[model samples]
Target: MNKKQKKMLIRILISAALLIGFNFLPFGGPLRFILYLIPYLVIGYDILIKAFKGIKNRQPFDESLLMAVATIGAIAIAIYSEVADHENGDYVEAIAVMLFYQIGEWFQSYAVGKSRRNISDLMDIRPDYANIEIGGKLEQIDPDEVEIGSVIIVQPGEKVPIDGIVIEGESTLNTSALTGESLPRDAQEGDEIISGCINMTGVLKIRTTKEFGESTVSKILDLVENASSRKSKSEDFITKFARVYTPAVVYSAIALAVLPPIVRMFVMGIPAEWGIWIYRALTFLVISCPCALVISIPLSFFAGIGGASNAGVLVKGSNYLETLSQTKCVVFDKTGTLTQGVFEVNEVHHNEMDRDDLLEYAALAESASSHPISKSLQRAYGKQIDRSRVTDIQEISGNGVMAKVDGIDVAAGNSKLMDRLGVKWIDCHRAGTIIHMAVDGRYAGHIVISDIEKPHAKEAIQLLKKAGVEKTVMLTGDSGKAAEHVAADLGIDEVHAELLPADKVSQVEALMKRNTGKGKLAFVGDGINDAPVLSRADIGIAMGAMGSDAAIEAADIVLMDDDPIKISKAIRISRKCLRIVYENIWFAIGIKLICLVLGAVGIANMWLAIFADVGVMIIAVLNAIRALFVKNL
Candidate 1:
C-alpha cells in the first residue's frame, strides 16, 4: 500500500475499535455522544474538510459532500433523539460508513497499482546501457549516446541495445518480450535484429542501424504511455453522465427530505415527523454516489490495453480498442499479410536442354537485375556466376531479361519476350509465374516461381470465421490465377485481383460501405503501399516485424511478430473489455437505483446505504481488474 493508504488504513482500524468500544459502554446521553464523536472525527475529519472545501469552491455535489452530509446529519439526529426522548440512538453506523468507504478507496488504489505493474513489466525493454566496442575493448555507455553505425557488443542474457544488422557472431535471441512468442529465434551474421530482444546464447556483434530514440522499443513505449489520453465513447459517456447524474440525485435527495415533510403537515393535516423523514433522505444521499460506474469503466479499458500489450499487440488508444470489438469484416493484403511474400523456384518444365543448364542460363541472364524472381533464380542456382562469360545484358520492363551468355544471344522472359524473339514457347499449366526462355534462337524450358502462403494463414482465416467475422476479403496486385489459388488455399471469402495500390484502397472502401449498422471493417497489411488503405479502414493493423514504417505509422493496431492470428486475439481482448465495461455500468446503476428508492422510502438504513455505495464499488473494481489477466485468451 502507498503511504496515504497505509495512514488511512491505520485510522480506520483505530476508529473501528473506538466505535465498537463506545457502542458497548454503559454510559448514555452526553458521555456516550462525546465518545462517539472522538471516533467519528478521527475517521472522517478529512472527509468533512473536503466537503467544506468543495462547497467553498462552488462544486459541492461530489461523493465527499454526500458522505459528509449523510454521516453528520445522522449523528445530529441521534444526539437530538437521545437527549429529548431518553431513547438510545446509534452513531456507530456513521463511523462505520466512513471507515468502510476508506477501505474501499484503498482497495481501488491497490487494484490500479496492480494493473499498472502488468503494463510496466512489459516495458522493461528499455536498455540501461549499450556496450560499444571502443579501442578494441567494450565500454558501457548510455544507449542514447551510442551513435548509428557504431558496433555494439551484446553479451548473452542482455538486451539488444539498438536496431542493427548482425555483422559478426551468432546467438539465439529470446524475443518473447517483444513478440509474445516464447520460442527462441536463431540469429546469425547479416540478419537484421531489432532492439528489445534478449540475446539468450552467444555474444553478438551488431552494427547499429537506428538511434536509440527511433528504435522499436522507444516507439512502443511512447505508444503505450500516451494510450490513455484518447478515451473511448464509453468513458466519455460516463464522464458526462456523472457530471449530470451526481447533481440530479443530490437535488432529488433534498426534495425527498423537504417536500414530503411539508406535504404531511400542510396538505394531509398530519404531524411532519421530520426526524424520521430526514434520516431517510440522508440515507438516500449516501446511496446515490456514482463512484462505481465512474471508476470501473475506465479501469477496465486500461487493463484491456495493458493485456493486449503483453500479447504483442499494441492498441493505439481506448477508442480503437472499443472499435475493434465491433469488427465484422476483415480485409487483408495478399502478400506479406496472408502469404510469405518471398518467391521461390517451384519447378522447371519443358526442358529442351538439361534442367541444370536451363537454370544456369536463367540465373546468368537475370544476374544483373535484383527483382524477386531474379533472386529466386540465383538462389536456386546456388553458385556464384562467372560474369566474364556473360555480356550485353538487357532488361525488358514487364517482360523479363535478355543477355549474351558465352557470346551467345540468350533471352529469358515471359511469353511477351518470347513473342518478340519469334521463338515458339509452351505455356506451362501452373499456379505461379512461368518464365519461358530461348537459347541461341531455339525454345528452352520454363521455370515456375510463386509466392507461398504462410503456414498458419488457413488457420488464421478459420479462427476469424469462428470469432464471428462475417466477411473475409483479400486484395492483391497478383494475377487472377495466382491470387485465386492462394485465396482458395487460405479459405478467403473474396478476392480482388490484379489491383494497384489505389485500387486496393477502393476495394477496402467498397467493402467498408458493405458493412452496415454497428459493424466495422479492419484492414491488415505489411507493405509500404498499404498505408493509404490502412488509414482508410476502421481499424488498421500492421505487421510490425516486417512492415514498412509508413504502414506502421498509419495503423491503429500493430502485431509485433507479424502473426495473423493475433488479429483475432486483439478483437477478443477488445470484446472482453467492452463486456466488462457494460457489466459494471448496468450492474452499478441497477443496484444504486434500487437502493436509492428503498432508502428514500425508509425501507433501507444508513448501513445498507454504505453497502450500496462502497461495497458495490469494491466489487466492480475487482471485476475491472480481471481485464489484466489475458494469458488464456
Candidate 2:
C-alpha cells in the first residue's frame, strides 16, 4: 500500500472503534452530538476538503462532490434530530459510508499498481550499461553513450545492449523477452542480433549497427510506455458521458429534494417533511455517483495492452486494439508475410545434360546478377562458379541471361529467351518460376524454383477462421499460377495475383468496399513496397523480425517474432478485452439506474446506497483486472 492508503487505513480503524464505543455511552443532548461529530470528521475530513476544492476550482460535479453532499446532509439531519426531536440520531451509518469509500479507493489504487507492474515486468529488458573495450580492459558505460560501429563485449547472461553484428565468438541467446519465444537462438560470427536478447553461454564481440535511440529495444519500450495516452472510442465515449451525466444527476437530485416537497405543500396541501425528503435526496446522490463506470472502463483497455505486450505483440494504442477486435477481413501480402520469402530450387525437369551440369552452367551464366532467382540458382549448384569458363555474357531486361560457357553457347532464361534463339522449349506445368535453358540452339530443359511457405501459415489461417475472421485474402506480385497454387494450399478465400503496389492498394480498396456492412479490413505486409497499402487499410500489421523499416513504421501493430499465428492471438486478446469492457458498463449502469429509482421513492436508505456505490465499484474493478491474464492465448 502507498503512504496515503496506509494513512487512510489507520483513520478508518480509529473512526470505526470510536463509532462502536460511542454507541454504548448513555450521554445525551449536545455532549453526545459533539462526541459523534469527532468520529465523523476523522473519517470524512479529506472528502470534505476535496469537495470544497472542487467547488473552488469551478468543477464540482464529480464523485467527491456527490459523496460530500450526501454524507454532510446525513450528518446535518442526525444532529438536528438530536437537538429538536429529543432523540439520539444515527451517526454510525454516515461514518461507515466514508470509511468504505476509502476502502474502495484503496483497492482501485492497488489494482492499477498491479496492472502497471505486469507491463513493467515484461519490459525489464533495458540494459543499464554496455561493456566497451576502450583500451586493453573493458569499461562499462551507459548504452546511450556508445557510438555506432563501436565494438562491445557481451559476457555470459548479459543483454546484447545494442543492435549489432557479431564479429567474433559464438553463443546461445535467450530471446523470450523480445520475441516471446521460449527457445534460445544460436548465435555465431557474421550473424546479426538485435538488442534485449540475453547472451546465454559464450562471450561475444559485436559491432554496433544502430544508435541506442534507433535500436529495436528502445523503439519497443517507447511504444509500450506511450500506449495509454491513445484512448479508444469506448474510453472517449465514457469520458464524454461522465462530463454530461454527472451534472445532470446533481440537478436531478436537487429537484427530487425541493420540487416534490414544494408541490406537496402548495398544490396538494400536505405537510412537507423536509428532513425525510432531504434524506431521500441524499441517498439518491450517493446512488448516482459514476465511479464504477469511470474507473473500470479505462483499466480494462490498459490491462489488455499490457497482456498483448507480454505475448510479443505490440499494439500501438488502445484505438488500434479496438479496431483489431472488429476485424472480419484480413488481407495478407504473399512474400515475406505468409511465405518464407527465400527462394530455393524446387526441381530440374527433363534435363538433357546432367542436372548438376545444367545447374552449373546456369549458375556460371547468372553469377554476376544479384536477383533472388540468381542467388537461388547459385545456392542450388552448391559449388564455386569458375568465372573464367564463361565469356560474352549478356543480360536481357525482363528476359534472362545469354552467355558462352567454356566456348559453348549457353542460354539460361525464360521461354522468351528460348524463342529469341530459335530453339523450341517444352513448357513445364509447374507452379513456380521456370528458367528455360538452351545449349548451341538446342532446348536443354528448365529448372523450377519457388518460395516456401512458413511452418505455421496453414495453422494461422485456420485459427483465424476459428476466431471469427470471416474472409481471408492474399495479394502478391508473383504469377497467377504460383499465387493460385499457394492460395489453394493455404485455403485462402480470395487471391489477387501479379499485382503491383498500386494494384495492391486498389485491390484492398475494392475488398474494403465489398465488406461494407462487415467489420474493418486489416492488411498485413512486410516489404517497403507494401508500406503504402499497409497504411491505407483499416489496421496495418507488420512482421517486425525481418520486415522493412518503412513497413514497420507505417503499420499500426507489429508481430515481433514474425510469426503469422500471433495475429490470431492479438485478435483474441482484443475481443476478450472488449467483452470485459461491455460487461462492466452494463453491470454498473444497470445497478445504478435501479438504485437511483429506489432512492428517489424512499425505498432505499443510506447504508444500501453505500453498497450501491462502493461495493459495485470494487466488483467492476476486479472484473476489469481479468483483461491482464492472456498467457493461454
Candidate 3:
C-alpha cells in the first residue's frame, strides 16, 4: 500500500474501534450523540471537506456530496427522534457508512497503483546516458547531445542509446523489453539495431543514425504515455451517464423524503411519520452513488493497453482498441507482411551465354540500384561488385536498369524493358518474378527470383478465421501470377495484385464500402508505400521491426517483433478487454438499480446501502484489473 492508503487504513481502524466501544456504553442523549460524532469526524472529515468544496465550486452532484448529505441527515433524524420521543438516539449507522466508504476508496487506490507498476515495469527501456570517446577517455553524455554518424561505445549490459548500425564487435542482445520475447538475438558488424535493446555479452561500437527523440524508445514511450487521453466510446458513455444519473437520483431522493410524508397527513388523514420516510431517503441516496460504473470502465481499458504492451503489441489509444475488437475483415500487404521479403535467385532460364557470365553482367548492370531484385542477383554472383566496370547507368521507373558493362550494352528488367530495347524476349512460365536480360540489342536470357513465405503466415490466417474474422485478403505490388501463388499457398480468401501505392488506397476504399455495417476492416502492412493504405483503413497495424518509419507513424497498432502470429494475439487481447468493459458496465448498473428500488420501499437499511455502494465498487475494480492478465489469451 502507498502512504496515503496506509493513512486511510489507520483512520478506518480507529473510527471502527471508537464506534464499537461507544455503542457498548450506556449513553442516552447528547452524550451519546457527542461520542458518535468523534468517530464520524475521524473517518469522514475529508469527505465532508470535499463535499463542501464541490458545493462551493458549483459541482455538487458527485459521490462525495451524496455521501455527505445522507450521513449528516441520518444524524439529524436520530437527534430529532431522541428529542421528540425520548428514544435512545442511534448514531452508529451514520459513522459506519463513512467508515466503509473509506475502506472502499483505499482498495481502489491500491488497485490503480498496482496497474501503473505493471505498465512501468514492461516499458523500462529508456537509456540514461551514452558513452562517447573523448580525449582518450570515455565520457557519459546525454543521448540527445550525440549527433548523427558519431560512434559511441556500448559496454556489457548497457542499453543501446540511439538507433544505429553496429560498426565493430559482436554481442548478444536481450530484446525482451522491446519484443516481449526472452530469447536473445545475435548482433554483428553491419547489422542494424534499434534503441532500447540491452547488450548482454560483448563491447561494441555503434554509429548513431538518429537523435534520441526520433529513436524507437522515445516514440513508444510517447505513445503509451498519451494513450489514456483518447477515451473509448464506452468510457464516454459512462461519463455522460454519471452526469445525468447523479442529479436525477438526488432529486428523486428529495421527493421520497418529503412528498409521501405530506400525503400521509393531508390526503390519507394519518400521522405524517417524517422520521421513517427521511431515513429511507438517506438510504436511497447512498445506494445511488454511481461510483462503480464511473471508475471501473476506464480502468478496464487502461489495463488492456498495459497487457497488450507486455505481449509486444502497442495500441496507441483505447479508442483504437475498441475498433480492433470489431474487426471482421483483415487485409494484408503481401511482401513483408506475410512473406519473408527476402528474394533469392531460384533458377536461370533461356541462357544462351555462360551462366557465370550472365549473372556477372546482370549483377554489374544493376549494382548501383539497391532494389531487392538487384541485391538477389549480386548475392547469386558470389563476388564483390566492381562499380567501375559499369557506366551510364539509366534506371526506368516501371521497367528496369540499362547500363554498359565492359563497354558493351547490358539491359536487365522485365519483358517491358526488353520490348523497349527492340529485342525479342521469351516469357518464362514460372510463378516467381522473372527478369529478362538483353546484350548488345539481342535477347540473352532471363532469371527467376521468388520470395519465401513466412513460417507462421498460413497459421496466422487460420487463427484469424478461428477468431471470428469473416474474410482475409492479400494486396501486393507483385505480378498476378506471383501474388496468386502466395495467396493460394497461404490460404488467403482473396487477392489483389500488381497495384501501385495509389492503387492500394483505392482497393482499401472499395473494401471499406463493401463492409458498410458488417464490421470494421483492418489493413496490415510494413513498407513505406503501405502508409497511405494503413491510415485509410478502419485500424492500421504496422510491423515495428524492419518496417519503415512512415508506416509505423501512420498506424494505430504496432507489432514489435514483426511476427504474423501477433496479429491474432492482438485481436484476442482487444476482445477480452472489451468483454471485461461490458461486463462491469452491466453488472454495476444492474446491482445499483435493484438496490435503489428496494431502498425506496423501505425494505433496505443503511447496512444494505453500504453494500450497494462500496461493495459493488470493490468488485468492479477487481474485475477491471483482470484485463492485465493476457498471457493465456
Candidate 4:
C-alpha cells in the first residue's frame, strides 16, 4: 500500500478502537453522539470532501453523491430521535455504515493499484540503455538516444538493446523475456537478435538496425500501456450503462423521496410525514450507487489481462480477452510455428560409403559456414573434424560448402552444390531433400535435412479440442504433400497448402465465412508471411519465440512460448477470469435488488442499506482480486 492507503488504514484502526471502547461504557445521550462522531469523521472525511467538490463543480451525480445523501440521512435520524422521540443517539449505525463504505473504497483503490502494478512489472522487460559504438569507442547511452545503424555491444547476461544484426561475436540468448520459450537459442555472426532477449553467454557486438522507439521492446511496452483503454463488448456495455445509470438512480431516489410524501398529504388521510420516507429515499440512493458493479467488473478484466502478462501472453485489451474466451476455431501456419523453425539433418543417405564417413566429411566441409542449413549438417555429424586434415574451403551461397578433406576434393551441400562439383546423380524420392555429397568428384551420399515437428505438436491438437476449440486448421506455403503430412500427423481438421501470405488471408476469410462465425477464429503464426493472415483473423495468436515484429504487431494475442498448447491454456484462463467477473457483477446486483425493495418499504434502515452498498463493494472487489492468482493457469 502507498502512503495514503497506510494513513487511511491507521485512521480506520483508531476509529475501530474508539467504537469498540465506547460500546462497553454506559455512554448515553449526548456523550454517545460524540462517540459515534469519531468513527464518522474518521471514515467519511475524504468522501464528504469529494462530495462537496462535486457539488461545487456542479456535477453532483456520482457515487460520492449517493454516499453523502446516505450519511446526512443517518445524522438527521440521530437528531430527530433525540429531539422528537426522546431517544438516545442512533449515530453509531451512521458511523459504522460510513466506515464500512470507506473500507470498500480503499480496498478498490488498492486492487486497482495492484492490477496496474502487474502490467508495469511486465513492461519492465524493456531495457533502459544500450552500449553504443561511437567513433570506434563503446559508450553507454540511453536507449532513446540511440539511433539507427549504431553498433551496440550486448555482453553476457545483459539484454539486447535494440533489434539488430550480429556483426561480430556469438552467444546463446534466453528469449523467455520476449518469447515465453525456456530454451536458449544459439546466435552467431550475422544472425538477428530482437530487443529484450538476455544474452546467456559470449560477447555479442550488434549493429542497431532500428531506432530505440522503433525497436521491438518499445512497441511491446506501448501495446501493454494502451491495452486497457480498448473495451470488450461486456466492458463497453458497462461503460454505457454507467453513464445513464447514475442520473437515473439519482432521479429515482428523488421520486422515492417526493412522490410518497405528496400522495400521503392529498390522496390519503394521513398527514405528510417527510422524515420517514426521506430517510428511506437516502438509503435507496446508497443501495443504488452501483460502485461495486462499475469498479469491480472492469477491475476483473484488468486483473485478467495482468495475469496473462505474467504468463508472457499479451492480450491487447479486454476486447481480445473476451474474443479469446469465445474462440471455437484455431488456424496455424506451418513453418516456424507448428514445427521448429530451424532445419536439421534428419537422415543421411549413403549408397556406397558408410553413413559415419559421409557425415564426418560433410561436417568438416560445412563447419566453417554460418547458414542455418550448414549448422544442421554440422550438428548431424555430432563431432569435431580435424581441421589439419582439411584444405581448399569454399562457400557457394544458395548452394553448399566445398573443401578438401585428407587430399580428397570433397563437396557437401544441396543438389546445387553437387552439380557445381560435377558429381553423379543418385535418384531418391523422399519427403525432404537429401543433400547429395560428392566425394572425389563422384556421387557419395545425400544427407536429408528438414524442419522437425515440435514434440508437443500432436498433443497440442488433442488439448485444443479438449479445451473447447471446435475446429483446427493449418495454412502454409509449404508443399501440399508436406502440409497434408503435418496436418494428418497432428489430426488437424483442415489444411490449406502452397499459399502465399495473401492467399493465407483469403483462405482464413473463406473459413470465417464457412463457420456460423458465432465465436472468433484465431490465426497462429510466427513468420513474416504469416503476419497478414494473423491480422485478418478475428484474433491473431503469434509464437513470440520466433515471431517477426510484423506478426507480433498484427497479432491480438502472443504466446511467449512456441508451444501450441498455450493457446488452449490461454483460452481456459480467459473463460475462468471472465466467469469470476460475471460472478462479482451478479453478487453486487443481487444485494442491491434485495436492499432496494426493503429500503423502499421502510424495513431496511441506513446501516442495512450501507451494507447493501459498501459490503457488496468489498465482496466484489475481493472477487476481482482472485483474477491475479490465476497464474496457476
Candidate 5:
C-alpha cells in the first residue's frame, strides 16, 4: 500500500475504534453524543465539506451529499430523542460507513495511479536521436531532422534509430524488443533493419529509407498514447447510467420524505411529525448515492487498460477489453506475424553448379542489390566477398540483379529474372521465392528463400485454440505455395495468399461475414501492409518493432514485441477483465436494488441500507482491483 492507503487505513481503524467504544461504553446520553462528535468530525468532515462545496457549485447531488445527509440525520435523532448510543445504531454507524468507503476509494486510487505510471514508462521507449552518416563522418542528429534516404551508422551496442537497409558492414540485432523473441538475428549487407532494435554485435552502415516519425518504434509509442481517448461500450454505458441514475435516486429520496407525512395527515388524520420518516428518507438518499458504482467501475477500466499497456499490449479502450472476451475467430497476417517476416535461404538446390559455388556466385551477382532476399543469401554464404569479381552490375528494381561475375554473365531472382534472361528455369516445388541463377544466359541452379515460420508460431495457434478461438486464418500477399507451407506448419485453419493490400481487406470482410452469430473477428498483423485489413476487422492487432505507424494507428490492439502467443495472452487478460467487470456490475446493482426495496418497506433499517450501498461498494471495488495484478492472464 502507498502513503494514501496507509493514511486511509489508520483513519478507518480510528473510526472503527471510536464506533466500538460508543457502542459498548457506559456513557450517559448527552455526554455520549458529545463524545461521538469527535470521531464523527474526524472521519466525516471531508464528506461534509465536499457536500458544502458541491451545494455552492450547484452540483449538490453527489456521494458526499449522501454521506453528509445520512450522518447528520442520525445526529438529529441523537439531539432530539436525547438518545445515547442505544437501540439499533447511532451516528457511529454513519461515521464507520463513510470511513470504510474512503478505504475502498484509496485502494482504487492507488491501483489506478500505478497503472497510469506504467503507461508513462512505455513512452520512454521512444528514441530521441539518430546517428546519421553525412558525407564521410557520422553525426548525432535529432531523429525528426534526419530525412529519408540518409545513411545512418548503427555501431555495435547502439539502437537502430530509423528503418533502413544495410549498405555496408554486418551485425546481429537483438530484435526481442520488437518481436519478443529471445534469439538474436544476423543482418548483413542489403538487409532491412527496423528502428528500436539494439544491434548486439558488429557495426552496421544503414541507409535510412524511412523518416524518423515513420519509424517502427516511434509509431508504437504514439499509438499507445492515443488508445485511451476512444471509449468502449461498457464505458459509455457507465457514463449514461451515472447521469440518469444519480438524478432518479435523488428524486426518489425527495418523494420518500414528502409523500409519507402528507398521506398520514390527509387520509389517516395522524399528527405528521415528518422528521421520523424524513430521517429514514435521508438515510435512503445516502444509500442510493451510487458513488461506489460511479467511482469503481471507471477505475476498473482505467487500471485494466493501464496494466495491459505495461505488458506492451495497447487496448484502444475498455470496450475492446470487454469485446476481447467474446472473440471467436482470429485472422492473422502471415509475414512478420506468425512467421519471421525475414526471409532466408532455408534450402539450396545446385542442379549442376556447386551449392557453395552457386551461393557465392549468386551473392556476388546480387551484391549491389538492396533487398531482403538478396541480403539473406549473402548472410548465409558468409564467404570472403571479392568486390572486384563483379563488373557492370545492373539492379533491376522489383525483379533481380544482373552482373558479370568472374567474366561470366550472372543473373538471379524470380521466374521473371529467368524470362528476362531468355533461359529455361527450374521451379523449386515449394513455397517462397525460387531465385533462378543463370550463367551466360544458361540455367545454372535455383536457391529458394522463404520466411521461416516462428518457433512459437505453431504453439501460439494451439494456445489460441485452447483459449477458445474457433478459427485461425492466415491471409498474406505471399505466394500460394508459401502460404500453404506456412499455414500447414503453423496449423492454421485457413490460408489465403497471393493477395494485394485491397484483397486482404476483402478477405477480412468476407471472414467477418462468415463469422458465427455475433462472434467478433480479429485481424492480426505486423501493422504494415495490413492497415486496411486491420481497420476492417472487429479488432486489429499489430505485432513487433517493425510494425508501420499506419498499421499501429489503424490497429485496435498492438503487441509491443512480435509474439504470436500474446494473442492468446491478450485474449486471456481481456476475459479476466470482462469477467471482473460483469461481476462488479451484477454484484453492485443486485445488492443495492435488493437492499433498496427492503429499506422502502421499513423491514431494513438505515444500518442495513448503509451495508447495501457502501458495504457492497467496498466489496465490488475490491473485486475490481483484482484486474490490476492479474497479469498472469
Candidate 6:
C-alpha cells in the first residue's frame, strides 16, 4: 500500500472504533450528538472539502458532491428528530456510508496501481546506457548520445542500446522483453540486432544503424504512454451518460423530498410528513452515485492493453482494440506476413551455360538492388561480390535490372524484362518466382527462387476461422501461380496476385465495400509498399520485428515477434476484454436502477443505498481487473 492508502486505513480503523465505542455510553441529547459528530467528521472531512471545492469551482456535479449532500442531509434530519420530538438522533448510517465509500476508493486505487506496475514491468526494455570503447577503455554514456555508425560493445547481460548489425563476436540474445517469447535467439557476425534485447551468453560488437529516439524501445514506450488518450465508443457513451445522469438524479431527489409532502398536505388534507420523505431523498441521492460506471469502464481498457503488451501484441488504443473484436474479414500480405520471406534458390533450369556461371552473371547484374530476389541470387552464388566486375547498372521498376558484367551486357529479371529487351525467353512450369537471365545477345537460362511458409501460418488461418472470422484473403505481388499455391495450401478463401502498392490499396477498398456492414476488415502487412494499404484498411496490423519503419508507423496494432499466430491471439484478447467491459456496464447499471426505484418508494434504506453505491463499485472494479489475465485465453 502507498502512504496515502495506509493513512486512509488508519483513519478508517480509528473512526470505526469511535463509532462502536460511543454506542455503549449512557449519553443523550447534545452529548450523544457531539460524540457521534466526532466519528462522522473523522471519516468524511475530505469528502466535505472536495464537495466544497467543487461548488467553489462551479463544478458541483460529481460523486463527492452527491455523497456530501446525502450524508449531511441525513445528519440534519437526525438533529431535527432529536430536537422536535425529544428522541435520540441516529448518526451511524451517515458515518457508515462515508467509511464504506473510502474503502471502495482504496480498492480502486490499489487495483489501478497493480495494473500499472504489471504493464511497467512488461515494457521495461529501455536501456540505461551504451558502452563505447575509446582509447582502449570502455566508457558508458547515455543511449541518446549514441550516433548512427558508431560501434558499441554490448557485454553479457546488457541491453543492445541501438538498432544495428553485429560486426564481431557471437551471443545468444534474450528477446523475451521485446517479443514476449521465452526462447533465446542467436546473433553472430552480420546478423541484424535491434535495440532492447539483452545479450545473454557472449560479448557482441554492434554498429548502430538508428538513433536512440528512433529505436524500438522508444517507439513502444511512446505508443503505450499515449494509449489511454484514445477512448473507445463505450467509454465515450459512459462519459455522456454521467454528465446528464447526475444532475437529473439530483433534481429527482429534490422532488422526492418536497413534492410528495406538499401534495399530501395541500390536496389530501393530511399532516405533512417531511422527515420521512427527506430521509428517502437522502437514500435516493446515495443510490444514484455513478462511481462504478465512471471508474471501471476505462480501467477495463487499460487492463486489456496491459495484458496484450505482455502477450507481444501492442494495441495502439482502446478504440483499436474495440474494433479488432468486430473484425470478420482479414486481408494478408503474402511475402513477409504469411511466409518466412526468406527466399532460396530452389532450382536452375534451361541453362545454356554452366549453372554457377549463369548464377554469377545474374548476381553481378542485380547486385545493386536490395530486393529479396537479388539477395537470393547472391546467396546462391556463395561468393564475395566485387562491384568492379559490374558497371552501368540500370533498374527497371516492374521488369528487372540491365547491367554490364565483365564488359558484357547482362540482363536478369522476369519474363517481362526479356520480352522488353526483345529476347525470346522460355517460361518455366514452376510454382515459385522465376528470374530469366540473358547474356550479350544470347539466352542464358533462369533461376527459380521460392519462399517457405511460416511454421504457424496454416494453423493461424484455422484459428482465425475458429474465432469467427468469415473471410480470409491473401494479397501479394507474386505471380498467380505462386500466390495461389500458398493460398490453397493454407486454406485461404481468396487470393489476388501480381499487384503493386497502389493496387493493394484498391483491392482493400473493393473488399471493404463488399463487407460494408457485415464487420470490419483488417489488413496485415510488413513491407514499405504495404504502408498505404495498412492505412486504408479498417485496422492495420504490422509486423514489428524485421518490418519496414513506414509500415509500422502506419499500423494500429504491432505484433512484436512478427508471428501470424499472434493475430488470432490478439483478436481473442480483444473479444474477452470487450466482453468484460459490457458485463460490468450492465451489471452495475442494472443493480443501481433496481435499488433506486426501491429507495424512492421507502422499501429500501440507507444500508441498501450504501450497497448500491460502494458495493457495486467494488464488484465492478474487481471485474475490470479480470481483463489483465489473458494468458489462458
RMSD of each: 3.9, 3.8, 2.3, 7.3, 6.6, 2.0
- lDDT ranking, high to low: 6, 3, 2, 1, 4, 5
Model 6, 275-324: lDDT tens digits are: 99999999999999999999999999999999998888888899999999
Give each model's clash number.
Answer: 0, 0, 0, 1, 2, 0
Q: Ten consecutive residues with minimal summed lDDT in candidate 4?
A: 544-553
Comparing 1 with 2 on TM-score, the higher-scoring candidate is 2
Q: How do the predictions measure up, each by TM-score?
A: 0.88, 0.89, 0.94, 0.79, 0.75, 0.95
Model 4 C-alpha lDDT per residue in residues 1-633, reported as the tens digit of each score: 899989988888888788777777665677777767777788788888998999999988788887887778878877887878876657776677677777788788887987788667754678867886678887878988877887889988788879999999989998765654567899999998888888888999898888878877777777777788988888788778877888898898889989999999989968778888888888888888888888988888888877777677777888999889988999998776788868777788787899999988888887777656667777887776577888899876546678899899888766656676667667556665357789888888887766778988899899889988999999876555667878898899999875656788899999899876468898888845577787788888887443356756678887766777788878987898889878987788888999999999999987788788888888888888787665566
lDDT (CA) for every model shown?
A: 0.87, 0.88, 0.90, 0.80, 0.77, 0.91
Flag clash pairs in model 1: none
Residues 1-633 of candidate 3 have per-residue lDDT tens digits of: 788888898999999999989989886988888889999999999999999999999999999999999999999998998899898888888988888998888888889889989998988889999999999899999999989999999999899989999999999999988787788999999999889899999998999898888888888888888999999999999999999999999999999999999999999999999999999999999999988988899999999999999888889999999999999999999887898789999998765698888899999999999878899999999999998999999998767899999999999998778888899898777897888899888888999999999999999999999999999999987777889999999999999986777888999999999999999999998846688898999999997453246755889998888689999999999999999999998898899889999999999999999999999999999999999998997
Tens digits of lDDT, candidate 1, 1-633: 678878988888899898888778887877888889998988889989999999999998788998998888888888888877898778877788788877787788888987888789976788999998778888999999988999999999999989999999999999888777898889999999988899999999999999999887888888888899999999999999998998998889889989999999999999998898889988898899898998899999999999998898888999999999999999999878898878899998856599989999999999998777788899999999888888999997656789999988889887878999899888777887778889999998899889978888899999998888988999987657788898888899999986768888898888877776849999999836688988999989987553145655889988887678888888888999999999999999999999988998899998899899999999999999888777788
Model 4 residue 542 lDDT score: 84
Tell me the lDDT of candidate 6. 0.91
Writing each residue's lDDT as its tens digit, candidate 2 over 464-518 gives 9999999999998776778899999999999998676889999999999999889
- Scored by lDDT, model 5 comes in at 0.77
Identify the candidate with maximal TM-score: 6
Collision pairs in model 5? 179-562, 232-319
Give me the runs in candidate 4 sitting further than 4 Å from their true place: 14-42, 56-58, 131-140, 153-157, 165-172, 181-191, 199-204, 271-273, 343-450, 545-547
Candidate 3: which stretches are off by over 4 Å? Answer: 133-139, 351-354, 388-411, 415-424, 438-442, 544-548
Model 1 lDDT on a 0 to 1 scale: 0.87
User: lDDT: which is higher, 1 or 3?
Assistant: 3
The ten-residue window of minimal lDDT in model 3 covers 543-552
TM-score of 2: 0.89
